[model samples]
Target: MASSRSRRVEYDRFIPFRSAMDMDYARFALTMPSRPQRDGSRESPSSVAYQKLLDECILKNRSRILAFKSAPEAPASMLPQFDEPIRPQKKQQRRIPREPERVLDAHGMLDEDGLNLLDWGSNNVLAIGLDDTVCLWDDANKSSKVLLQAVEDSGPITSISWSPDSTVLAVALGNSVLALVDPATGQDVNVTEEDENQTPVLSLAWRSNSILTVGRSDGTVVDYDFRKDDTSICFYNGHRRGVCSLKWSALSGRYLASGGHDKLVHIWDACMPVSHHHPRRHQWLHRISSHTSIVKALDWCPTRSNLLASGGGRNDHCIKFWNTVNGACLKSIHAGSEVCALLWDKNKSELLTSHGSPKNQLTLWNYPSMTRAAELSGHSSRVHFLAGSPLGGVVASAAADETLRFWNIFETPKTTKPELPFAKFSVIR
Candidate 1:
């Protein structure tokens, strides 16, 4: 027994125990199975001591091992990689389809050159010039009446325009005169005629309550101020032929656009003082002669102030959009026929154009892109005039067929609103 004890102690000295944390020592000590001694009993003292030490070591290190495993600050190299990559979010695009809600017939409408035949008032009244008569049609009540008539000697009514307040209407006659009439009573409030030079008034546009610009057959536009003692302010001359179309920009009250049979478009600053001594009576911003035929279709963009769109006659068959600020031609589209009139959508970025020969149709277009949205064909003759209602999204077109057509092309879609037809669209806006 003494000799066996000595041998066991010598084996323990060869083990070289440094610390209990050594994984190899712990595995060897803890995993070893008990063996029977020479006396035929179970575990020996050295083996028993090792088993107790291993148990104590595991108990002491339990909390530390658990804490290290649960910590979140693990190195990047220890993180697992993913197979699939993340994608970016997609944006939704808005696309409005081309469709008409309804169309109406307007009889006794005229198709004349150098005439502002159709106009829509804020009170929802549409005034149309038919031959020598001026007619008023109530859009809300759907009624029509003869507003005024000119004698055969005085010639036919050439142009008509409603005031901003919808109270007064201006009627241009072929006899070089302009008659301001109250639509409520169908009576002339005042009549203003051109000077003795005998130039007839062809087109008329009202800029404000005090300002009226009249385009003449002598290639000049006369500014009439209601506030001044001498109502005839001055004349602005540019075109070499009859000025057929005149429009004042709503965005900038000072900007005016005039087109004529001379195949020229003149952008003028109307606010400039008329001085014959200054060499240039009118402040001409741009003189665009891109049209090969009569440039009668002229309109300023309501959404964009500096953008202008003009259409040409049968030979040109093109609608060109211009940037008034820089005098640049932004876009141009061929209508396949003569572009006679233009109307810009107020609530949306769209354009409505009327054609004369070949097609004689009304076309709805998307702005900037100049893409055709839809083509409305009904008129048997040339579609020459277009007017928009202040009630929103309703347009009335007059043609040479002596018919006026109403179209709800820009009407807003509403599924949840009540059936208040007249006020529904205006209320939503």
Candidate 2:
């Protein structure tokens, strides 16, 4: 009896919600006689004999289930005993309204890939491209100034981006020229010499205050160091068509994402060692070729360093999320129209996308869940651009209808100390 007690396997503890078939299987397993070779250990005769009567003998009788008894109690998991403190309930997300907070008239025949033409500077200024001119609107003062007017032959302003420090602005012209301007004094800082190849600069992204990445119509991407001579530091040549978008990772500033009319997005490593075989050329780390149309929208996650979001144009009309660490696609959703621009909310795990024809509206989505939170309609034409304000609460969207709208979709940032840009630096004694 003592030996039998030692092998008391709690196999008949019926888990709550278990089906009748499950109980029968459990009984079959529990009633099986132990074979001596099962664990390379011989069961004692007395224990084996006991098991035969309680398990095998009963099964052989063919009606032993009728004789079964209820288990003494449920397992510990079903108990109500406390094991840890209760966690506070998560704060619910604030719902975004379907109507925008404000709207303004903006006139321009904006280009198809005009993602950079509308940018909100860190200095609370909005830079907008209207026809052949570039205008700066200060949100604080509610005033406007024209920063640049391109000559008709020079081509319209294709793109404009502010440096990380917000001291200088980089403008790309359709004629394949770049100009750096100071925002405070509204003066030209540096203008690049016309490209000998004359490949129109289609997109611009600032890697740093003095380092800028330029995407051209010829599918070549150039990294220029403006600290001195505006020398080309690296060249990424993978796209076969015009490069429409270029965005650097806001987390580590190590990964650069480029998308284009080639229906491809390439992730490039900024710190790659130069190859002696091709000194100036650098190969891409991951080539994502899932989109079926022009991919003009690309943005790195502000919350997750390894996650990226890309959107396709009219033909594809899909938004895809990717694990940049391995180039694995995590999720994809059909937007039903051209996804012209994408942005992630800084205060929440949410995503916003601007669309083209059919709806010509802005969509706010709950991340990971991918559920629609709000669909805002205002643009009379394709909403080709989106820019978030410096304070992280408001967003400005530019559409082909020659108008810009502001929406209060994000929560106002909480009062918190700004993180040190260079964490390693400290005050010296």
Candidate 3:
């Protein structure tokens, strides 16, 4: 057996440098002393003998790519890579060949006169229009209540949308009145148009907490600020026909997309300057005349801020994806039936489309590839509308059959990190 001192010496070799820590050494010298300065010419004494600067300096005088003529040689790469490597992975199948988890007999849920009244709120509640009444169905409790019932002049509910915060619901009526309903009290703050030949409010979208964009049937889109007394921020008159669909970019809150029955999709920039010196009407960034028929469906990509999807009406059964950054057509698929609505999966790179007439089925497709992953069929008639929850796992479909169905379309992982929905945001100091 070796001596204990020898074993101690051998053990110290395997550890990190311990010259300053080894207490048994006869002389303990400080590697870096910070007492004071040296040379005592009005300066302090040797408080700290600072690290000595290298006397011999060497630098290459020539230029090189990415190196800037550093003296050190290239270091070996530690990246593990291989060619033609194939291995088994945990393949997760899309929730396929399944029926809706729950179904409710939703009477008077048909789409008429270009009105789609289906909106799922962030507070786990589903809202649908029953001809003249706006009903709220709580998804967590499966209980519903008649939130509002239109009477007399306000006959039918044209469109319904929940705000991002889910504190207020915007309900559009047939008689050109936009009612902002507080879900807690079922009270409405009505906004009316006083024009002699009044047009109906076809679509509505919330740009921010205070700003709401109301699209009228006469092709006039107004950005109304409820916080202000004047209310009207600006107006967009690009569409020649009824503006049917409106959606704002979720991340930047800059681009507002609108689709109209004139077969045109207009992308408006909220940052468009409205000068007080020389005021002008808000102009669209891009006027896309791609669809041959009425354009109604509009949705901005949840992951990609500049990407957008628009679907045409019956005469044109095509769903075209657009890159709003440069107004480029990314892809276009000819859906057999009239594409009613388009929704992106919140967790995966998948898209869900509900169709009308002929084959009234819901199809989930793997995006980018555009391959049909699964086809769902439960509705007897044309599936006119689709609304997904905030998380996008479960989707609610309303059809002409006057029925509402909920499908668990997405398979969520056990644990997931919350992704930043807005890709660009300043660091909060």
User: lDDT of all predictions, in order shown?
Assistant: 0.81, 0.85, 0.81
Clashes of each: 1, 0, 4
Worst 10 residues of 3 by lDDT: 48-57
Error of 2 at 239 (Å): 0.9
Per-candidate TM equals 0.72, 0.75, 0.74
Q: What is candidate 1's lDDT per residue for 167-267, written digit by digit as tens?
A: 89999887887889999898888887554776887788888976788888888888888666788776687788899999899888878999998999999
Clashes by residue pair, model 3? 35-47, 35-48, 36-47, 36-48
What is the per-residue lDDT of model 3 for residues 204-296, given as tens digits with 9 covering 90 to 100?
888876788888888999988887788887888699989889999997899999998889999988788865753647888899998988887
Among all windows of ten consecutive residues in candidate 1, which has the lowest summed lDDT?
Answer: 32-41
Rank list by lDDT? 2, 3, 1
Give the Cα error of residue 45 in candidate 3, in Å.
86
Return whichever of 1 and 2 wins on lDDT.
Answer: 2
Q: Per-residue lDDT for 98 in model 3?
A: 73
Show the colliding residue pairs in model 1.
106-404
Query: Compared with the true structure, what per-residue lDDT tens digits does model 2 show for residues 263-294?
Result: 99999987887689988888898999989999
